[model samples]
Target: MHENIDPAICPVCGGDNGCALLAGQPIEQCWCMRTRIPKEVLSAIPAERRGKACVCQACAAGSAPARPD
Candidate 1:
């Protein structure tokens, strides 16, 4: 994770990431625990933001428009 990134925001689209851990919940309780983010989707995160914040469900599921490359 990037040192200055907000874990609660989606690195891809700047939206809520819905991360349970960031919300004071357990990792196992996060939506990501049950969802398998695709390689393409994961790769969409900017290099600087990669591993910093989670991608929101909309972006991960291909519903949200990705940031312009």
Candidate 2:
């Protein structure tokens, strides 16, 4: 038999469960959820500019800037 696990919903915006692995930071009680950047997008961005790019759950859900990364 298989069991289902509830997703980690974001408390702030009610976003679906997500991991913060993308940012290389520990997951806290935050509104942000981490997402991996596409290779194409990463390649397009300069090394210095990479710091400016971020993929947060808030940003994904059109909320707020959760993390600077």
Candidate 3:
């Protein structure tokens, strides 16, 4: 499997943003995290686990693991 890592800077606030969202929350609860995932990798995630796995904007922009779509 792949190991996910968060970004050093927050894509939104441009600050030291760390991993805050969990692996199973509503998309609306963390829109920034979901938007960070790449289309290709997002597709790779299982449909059933999409909502369970999500990454913050910092991680997404950094090309980290994204929530499944």
Better of 1 and 3 by TM-score: 1
Q: How do all the candidates rank in terms of lDDT, highest first?
A: 1, 3, 2
Which whole-number lDDT from 0 to 100 does residue 33 have in model 1?
Answer: 90
Sort order, TM-score high to low: 1, 3, 2
Per-residue lDDT tens digits of candidate 1, residues 1-69?
Answer: 335778888988888999999889999999999998999999888888887789999988989977664
TM-score of 2: 0.25
- For candidate 3, give the lDDT of residue 67: 30
Q: Which candidate is the best by lDDT?
A: 1
Q: Taking the tens digit of each residue's C-alpha lDDT, what string does model 3 give over 1-69?
A: 763433433333334434444435564665564564677544554544354444345455654543332
TM-score of 1: 0.87
**lDDT: which is higher, 1 or 3?**
1
Instruction: Tell me the lDDT of model 2 at 17.
Output: 32
Which residue window of length 10 is worst by lDDT in model 2?
Answer: 3-12
Model 3 poorest 10 in a row by lDDT: 5-14
Please give, for residues 1-69, the per-residue lDDT of candidate 2 as tens digits. Answer: 543322343322333435554335566633343354445433433344344334334435444433223
TM-score of every model?
Answer: 0.87, 0.25, 0.31
Report the error of model 1 at residue 1, Å: 18
lDDT of 2 at 63: 48
